[model samples]
Target: MRMHEHPTINYPEYHWPAGKRCAVVFSLDLDAESPFLWLHRGQQVQQLGEIEQRRFGPRQGLARVVRLFAEYGIRGSFYVPGVVAQTYPGLLPFLLEGGHEIAHHGYYHERIEAIPVAQAEDYLVMAQELFCTQTGLSGLGHRAPSWEMTSDFLQTLERRGVSYDSSLMGFDHPYHVGNMVEVPVQWTVDDALYFRYTNSPRDKTHPANPGAVLDSWIEEFEGVRETGGLFMVTLHDWISGRSQRLRLLRKLIAHIRHDPQVWWARADEVAAWHAASPNRDLYRVPAHSINTHFESATRG
Candidate 1:
């Protein structure tokens, strides 16, 4: 049979709650060293320095991030992989105690679509279960490890009662995938593409110019503010927490915070607000980009 073609995705206008002009979500993927392990698989042990670099997030960078957020009174959202949460036991307690939101990231930081459907489901289940076991409640949101997404995996999330997901860039605003909302994310807002560098052959990213990143993010803020859209800024403990990158992040935050119309919220809060609205499925965006094609093929 010829490959099935999904209908052209429609771009619909979506609004934020509370009369806010822009909903800004500081979503952190606390992948730590797990991403390197997931990306390299069996070769992770060979990339010792990369592992150490990744560890910098939880080891020292996390404190700095925490301090900055406290200074700004921002209750940021953190997506913690279960392995990382288990590896660093004190991390989640401090985050929760500080009024931060801890969301589910995979268990082993596995790429959701790269693994089998059962494995992907297992990763999410383990992550969610561990989060519940650790915090005595469920995490309301999920940002798939490396922002991976698949239709089947999305179905899993909906079936398992996830309120929202942040792994897909389906639109400039949140849209429903069945009952579960997708709080969209884009690479332009992700810190890993702009930061994260190492000497290892497996290390492919280059250090982005801080000034350029700040300008781009600020520009994005302005554009999103106009639409009253959700500005889902994706950061990683290991990348954006670096001192130099952290400085850039500070500037970006300051710039966005300067606008009184910007609503600083956690990922789960944004998701929950969107979920509570009956208009969640009110808009739809085209998900058939080149990336979606690759994703569809991969899922097959």
Candidate 2:
């Protein structure tokens, strides 16, 4: 199908009721390092063949994240890697019990853009089945690991019962990608920023300084709210599971909870709202060569 042939996706435009400003969606990436790193490096592959660190794994971190979300009375999406789900069967039930949504993050956490098209399709299918079987809930959302999704990957998701994908960045609101609505923008407020700022290199095992990250995020949130847009915060089990990070998350949640206009919701809930509401053309800019400052603040 051609790029613009798909139906336009319409999202809701609910005003803050008087004092409200913006909506927030928190998404967690549940991934295991062994298979994920192995697929990329032979050294990690050999190391994984020797060690078994299943106990202090993705599920453990997920449990912590879920607990934190429950404390805030908020529901978010948990995008799990298939390998992680198979390794930890108890994780899915805990998420379901907490009323969180389970989304697919791909099988084995392989980079779909690097793999062959047929192989990528197989990986996506495997992920969907493993997530459904273990969780007893079929996932409707997809997020490519490492934020690496090509056009082919998007097409594969459209074919695999995926209703939305949250891998795209630089868009302020959700938009249709072919026949699927993409929950665009990830890495807006992530632990990776700490690593980048510290020049610590990208290591998921490293802990994130949550207070500093949250402070920066709050600033971004205020900016988006003033402009009437969506704020997407991406967290990873391995990174945000630390005590310091969790504490920062709680503080951020407290601020969001006090605001009546700020809707703290799940990705699916936001998608459903968009589908049911009228299209307001929220992200369109009036002129060519849009200024980066305005685009950065309002683009989904």
Candidate 3:
């Protein structure tokens, strides 16, 4: 395998608004089987275990997670699919009540890279409209369904007036995906890799132990503190909402709270600060580079 040339985002010299040591962005994704549904449309009836596991999110996990945030008095960026917002009406309202940042996570969790451009446009447009209609708030951030970023997708976000995205793995700090700011995410800081399973024979899931995940994330935070880079954590309600894993998340937050220098921010605030950054241009991906990088990733 090969690697694409990563973004040359210079986080070392950039000054944070709070002057904190490093930034920690905790974003929770409420995909809730929408991606599975999109992938298995015709056979949706047969995937009972998948359906119930995902259903566990909205049914019990959401409120638990919301209350956990309240206990800590810190807000998370909640990215929900448009269909999810519609499917579970109370979930959005609860998030809004907690003063969390609500952002777009594709309408049905469809992979924009695999769909036609027009189809992708319609899916995003309807999702944006429907979510706004439901909540009366428009999204300022977007996280691609499968962490798949492309030129067309970035353009779509730019045209929609979205200020930032949290889908790419290019850089840890907030940087540009075209004119749109990207808050990078990594597999290491995510719980799904450790927890999610689909009963597939080839899928090698991580251990059921939550301490391993907790310990690894702390290491990441401490290491990023050196450069004062942003530490973006991607979590799923369905996977991380279980009792033990939720405890893991709580401990993670508690551990971070121990550090007085860590800046706790939502993704939008990070984007706003980065947008005003004098070194902003250093991270901007030129028009042609998006396609070039995507091609390289595909080939590699």
Candidate 4:
């Protein structure tokens, strides 16, 4: 199909709960040391510096974040890898006590693209079970580590009774991806793009200044507000829980709170509202349809 000939659908005006004009979700990837452990699963962990850096997330960073949330009197979402929770033991209870939403990240913060689809599904099942076992919370939401997803993985989410998946970036607002409520994410607003700085040679650039990143995030928030979209800020505990970054977060929260029309919500709350609202089917974009379109466009 030609560019203009491609199929199109009319997306109704997205709505926020409580007559809010726009939505903002504060979500944290409480990754801790799971990602580093995943990268060196079998080999001996020689990168002690990086591992210790990530460990700071659970040891000190998360506590600082919890204090900040308490100060703001707002609840946020915390997506935890199974390994991190298991290692910390008290992590889930602490988050629950803080009135935060706990969602599934991965078993070990494994990248779905690097493993077989079956293995990835197994990890999902394992993580879900672990979360349920520890917190007694079922039907939790998921956000793929590294923001990666596949058709089979999406299907697994549906079969597992997942309330929503916040990995895809199809739209700034929540939409369906094959019957799953997709709470879209963008790298521009995610902290890893700006704050993830390991001393590894693979690092091509230095970490950005916290002030500059806060300015860019505020600019993006303004744009999203103007467009009446979701401003989902993804932060990692290790990367964004530092003192300077936390100050930036406080400023951002203060600025957002100034706007009375904004809806500050957790990820699952936004997903629930979208699932029940008129916008549910209005913005549906199933993954299979996109695969078919790509195949047709690239035909020999």
The prediction achieving the highest lDDT against the true structure is 4
Q: Is 2 or 4 the stronger prediction by TM-score?
A: 4
The 0-to-1 C-alpha lDDT of every candidate, in the order given, reads: 0.79, 0.68, 0.81, 0.89
Residue-wise C-alpha lDDT for candidate 2, range 56-97, written one tens digit per residue? 436366678778887778798888887777777777777888
Q: Write the per-residue lDDT of candidate 4 for residues 105-184, one digit (tens) a residue.
A: 98899998789988988888888888888889899999999889888888988998889999999788999987999999
259: Cα error in model 1, Å: 1.2
- Could you give the C-alpha RMSD of every candidate to the true structure, in order shown? 4.8, 7.4, 4.1, 2.6
Q: Name the top TM-score candidate.
A: 4
Q: Determine the backbone clash count of candidate 4.
A: 0
Q: How are the candidates ranked when ordered by TM-score, highest leading?
A: 4, 3, 1, 2
Q: By summed lDDT, which 10 consecutive residues of candidate 4 come out lowest? A: 290-299
- Clashing residue pairs found in predicted model 3: none
**lDDT of model number 3:** 0.81
